[model samples]
Target: MTASHTPRAKSADTVSALERGLAVLRSFSEDRPQLGHAELVRLTGIPRPTVTRLVATLVGAGMLKPAPVADRFMLGPGVVSLARVFLGSLDVRGVARPYLQSLAEEVGVSTYLAVRDGMEMVIIEACRPRTSMLAARLDVGSRAPLPVSALGRAFLSAVDEPQRQQLIDSLRLQRGPEWDSVAPAMHRAIAEARDLGYCLSLGEFHREINSVSVALIGPSGEVMALNCGGAAFMFTEQRLREELAPRLRTIAQAIAHAIGGHLPALP
Candidate 1:
């Protein structure tokens, strides 16, 4: 998923039914809780009969379940079950395992990979050293808000200024339960990160955890980040500045190389 992996040229081929079927499945969301055949036809602009057939097929396949209210369908346990398997197979951990281990070993802390997910970053992989003090046990699926975590700032640093500003504006509009006091400082942090090569969060996301991060852009220019984290007392400001930041830049460059693209100059 990095610059080293060139993307295949787009094909002019027609859309496949399977692709359309998946799109139909994706069209339903929390807002549009239940969908009927006619509603799906209106939403997808697919023919009514085809929508009906696909809905029936999906229902039979257990990807959709009949709603308690008559004549509606909702996403089923089958989708959740399949999605778990898919996420487990994503292999970000496999790709980042050695690098994260190396980073942890060098820094004597823990490292993690977090991918941007809408308004938050989801921790996809984590490598922790045996001796490091952990303020929190960040599991694979933990979600962290953008304004609080170094992983978010690393991603924000790589994005264009306009998008970064927009996300900051959005953050100003909403505040997390624990972060009302920290939001303004986080805004400054984001701007600072834009100026600096990377971002650092010092006990901002969690009370006793500190993290430093650098961004990685994939071959398609999609942004991801690598974050090294530990107890704030152990991962001191001096350590982040004098040690961890330099090593993170090296790991990110390696990831970009492995992923394939025109690599950006290291900051």
Candidate 2:
């Protein structure tokens, strides 16, 4: 879901229940999977009573399940069914499926494929190395902030200048004064992605992790990105620049070619 796909305004026709229900569902993510009732209220900003009702409803529908923790819940098998239906529908994911496993094994790290969804990048695919003991913890359907992630920066670098400006402006408005504080770093990252044909994230999203990424034009004309990431101990700055970046660029190109999409080139 890019900016263009977002509706300009919500009308009276909108359903608040549906919105709140979805918000409740979206509150569950890789980092916060088994949240208690009070935690859900804090995460969703919905009233505790409302959260309780929604949780009960979702549990009845089998979309959520009670966890081992006394009052906590996790996504249920029903959610996996829904995810399977969505993933099975994506031709791009199907095309890149084999390559994802191969690339993850080759790099000995976790890899992800993501696309812009409103103001965030949503991971739609993930692959982990066969023998690596380290867990990257990013899961399909998880969302990350667009301004601070390698995948997001890659998408930003791939978009047209006018659209990029519009996104930056929106970020400024949404973030208020804090936008100014992070703007320089985000701009530097975007420029690095544009110049090197890839983006780097060293302890930006997580303190002990590092990654390299590049974006591709999806078959539907949306921007999509691919990345490889691991613990910082396994990836020095020199190795990320000299080894991982080139491999990431090659992977992006190969995936782009497979999907008949455009690939960015290193300056």
Candidate 3:
């Protein structure tokens, strides 16, 4: 099922104003959390004059604030208010946080809980060990692309065949020529996930990272996924497949039970 907050447009005639506004908001990320007007123009490809007005409107709405370090802007309290409202409307996070946190600590890695949003997976919860030997740079609001992430492959495996094909078809259009080359590998990965109850990604997206993920039906009847991973050197492919995958699958089962979700049994 689709996420409630996922963007949608019924037709090509839909208003461009909201999309452009969101594009401006999305230009900020963990890597570039603050940006100046020029940087925003470069990032969003919205012309300088248009972006200037957009920035002004956002600032006026209290959605963007001036940065202390430089002549940049960071997302303001209004974004946090929006996030708070969205999170408060869901019980899954409250039910899953402690379990995910304990599991992350036990495994000494990063753990994530995410749901499909358009062609990507939006992280709803993420945890990292308090004293991790290796750092995995991910936060609750991070978005993982569908083509290359273990979270995405695991999610693809959990959905019905018809829906999966439909998504792939849409991806072909969205991702262009890259999807043609990536499809074979992704199909193999999804099938492997179906057999193993979890999917593995060894530097498929980020060369320095390796990950394992399992998708399950969420309490709200929407699909959600769990991911566990860290830096490549910290966990060998053999170790991830032989050891960590089982532990994650066990946690996936517990999460499934806790939230009235479906997690497949290992075959």
Candidate 4:
């Protein structure tokens, strides 16, 4: 898991200790699953003494366990239990799975349903063609950067201006000098989504991948993204725009309709 963007508490009633403890947990990721006290302190920018105490508390609470490597820790079963519960509670995932699965099998590509988590799109549901041996290996809980992935651009297209600007500003700050190089393509993707009702990322996020995605806005205005993608050679820009894009848009509309949200007009 990537670090979630948790906003700073402005109210006096918020618990700073709990916030710090959650930050400690968020420091762990798929690429860096195990961290020692010093690593956690550096990754989270918390004081060493505070990180030590927080790690001890988390270990005691079964949220962290000692790694086989000396003095390092891995996320524990408690985290899995919490994640299970959270995933189980998502009615939209249940509603979206069959449609996504059908899209995957029909197109011989992998499909995903993702929601924005801070500056990234986090996969809440994923499906791959049953007969396909070659597809993107993303699964539930996988994260994709918001500025490059089709899933992320679809999300950006669905959000209102103020929220989108806020996210763009944050990305500018986060990306620093690299924002100049990344911004133009991101802007084009957003425009494509708004105009065509879907966005395509052709060999953008990964050199060997191509994807098309559309936004699904829930009844309460919760925005999610749906994607259909596979190897770049298999899902070329022309094939995606001429073939897969319409199907992907239709699936998004079906999902929205099933979940009692306003159905998007098909192109």
Candidate 5:
């Protein structure tokens, strides 16, 4: 029932090095950046030596760097460089990049490529709109709570029923630090998204940003998602409901088709 145990069981079944490296990277976040060897060991639950080795490797690779005047370390400049490389190499991103760019240009907002990571969605790629005041605001490697994000809900809605149910069950237990409005609102939003073929997050993740997302499924039925977000003041809820949702669905459909997903019948 513990968060660590649940994901550990699932990850152990797969045992991917890439996944482990990501785990290590995710261990360092806003709440706990600049970890020493002992903190890293406890956070990742990996052996101290192994964590040290991984930290060393990451530091050498530029994914991590030693802190200015402390033994603790933080994310290195190499992360952005590697992220650019990773984004450049993804065939899905490459194919969808032009469309996302066009969408950002047309709508004058920011767009993101969201991929599932355990029970969360990570923003792997993003395109900023030139006209928006929030252009280049969200960091590329940012993480979002699945149950609270339009992109995460869109990905969930695209999945098969049984998996969706299981995922929902897990998320039901993993609500954010605050337990009030965010949790109940997400439940309603997801249900609405299931009916509409796209999801919307209106100022839940941020006070001033509104986001709309649609799924981009793969040939093998894997679910990814695309998100478009902007200042809520500039792109009001009414405008998003009327204009952005339809545009997101169209782009998501094209990306899904390019990646070999059957287009879902719109409701």
Candidate 6:
């Protein structure tokens, strides 16, 4: 199931112009870093004229700038500035980085710490084994799908029941016909997380990748997750379950203890 870049307004007080403008910005991604008004309109479902106006305003506000190519625009310094502020505010990243790096080096794999964003998990900290040539090609801003990714399922296991159900309902709506096929695996992942303090994604998110993840809760109850894995050939389901999952759980506990965070109780 594909997630929408544009968010739906949940209330009557929503400012549609602001929403549309944000949608225009959200249309830019790692794969599609630059877009023209026509592209924005197509991706965001906004009218062309509205997209044009939004682009003009965004460019004027320093949130976007013309790309090297004619009529195309890319996210600008303003977005970077905002991202810096957001990253700066995430204290957990600071606490988790060393542990993540240690795990990556020890396991000869990649490790990531992420938080939920709508129907996806956004990586805040990504670490790789410095001595190893093989690692997952993901960085701080990379996103993983909620239902299919171990990181995302671990996040689901961390949240309260109401929030989890709300997110699931939203996923159902977003996935449409695909929900039937996706639900069973997602439920299984959730169950694993609840039962074992971790979740596994064996070639579910990317057919070539396998990962295991554990959830963390901050002292004030903020939710986050950590995942470790690499190429499918190196991280088989048995290896993940027997070898990596225990270490991953230890790192989760260590991070939680360091940050005064909490790990979900296993049943």
Provide the overall lDDT of each model, using Cα atoms, as 2-decimal numbers.
0.74, 0.80, 0.81, 0.86, 0.76, 0.88
Cα displacement (angstroms), candidate 6, residue 256, comes to 1.2
lDDT of 3 by residue, 30-138 (tens): 7788889887777666678988888889999999988897778999999999988987876778877887888788878899988887678889999889987665577
Tens-digit per-residue lDDT, 153-181, candidate 1: 77776787798878776565555354568
Instruction: Please provide, for model 2 over 147-202, each residue's C-alpha lDDT reduced to its tens digit, 9 standing for 90 to 100.
Output: 88888888999998999999888777656768877778789989998887888888
Predictions ranked by lDDT, top down?
6, 4, 3, 2, 5, 1
Q: Each candidate's TM vs. the true structure?
A: 0.65, 0.80, 0.82, 0.92, 0.79, 0.94
lDDT head-to-head 4 vs 5, winner = 4
User: After superposition on all CA atoms, what RMSD does each candidate show versus the true structure?
Assistant: 9.0, 4.4, 4.4, 2.6, 3.7, 1.9
Model 4 steric clash total: 0
Q: List the residue pairs that clash in candidate 2.
A: none
Could you tell which candidate, 4 or 5, scores higher by TM-score? Answer: 4
Per candidate, the number of residue pairs that clash is: 10, 0, 0, 0, 0, 0
Clashes of 2: 0
Candidate 5 residues lying further than 4 Å off, grouped into runs, are 1-7, 10-22, 30-33, 38-42, 45-64, 75-89, 176-181
- lDDT, residue 92, candidate 2: 80
Better of 1 and 3 by lDDT: 3
- Which candidate number maximizes lDDT? 6
lDDT of 4 at 188: 99
Q: Write the per-residue lDDT of candidate 4 for residues 90-172, one digit (tens) a residue.
A: 89999889988988888899999999977889999999998875577889998888999999999998888999999998888
- Residue-wise C-alpha lDDT for candidate 5, range 5-73, written one tens digit per residue: 122545445865555566677777665768788777666667678777888888998999999757899
Candidate with maximal TM-score: 6
Worst 10 residues of 6 by lDDT: 1-10
Q: In terms of TM-score, how similar is model 6 to the real structure?
A: 0.94
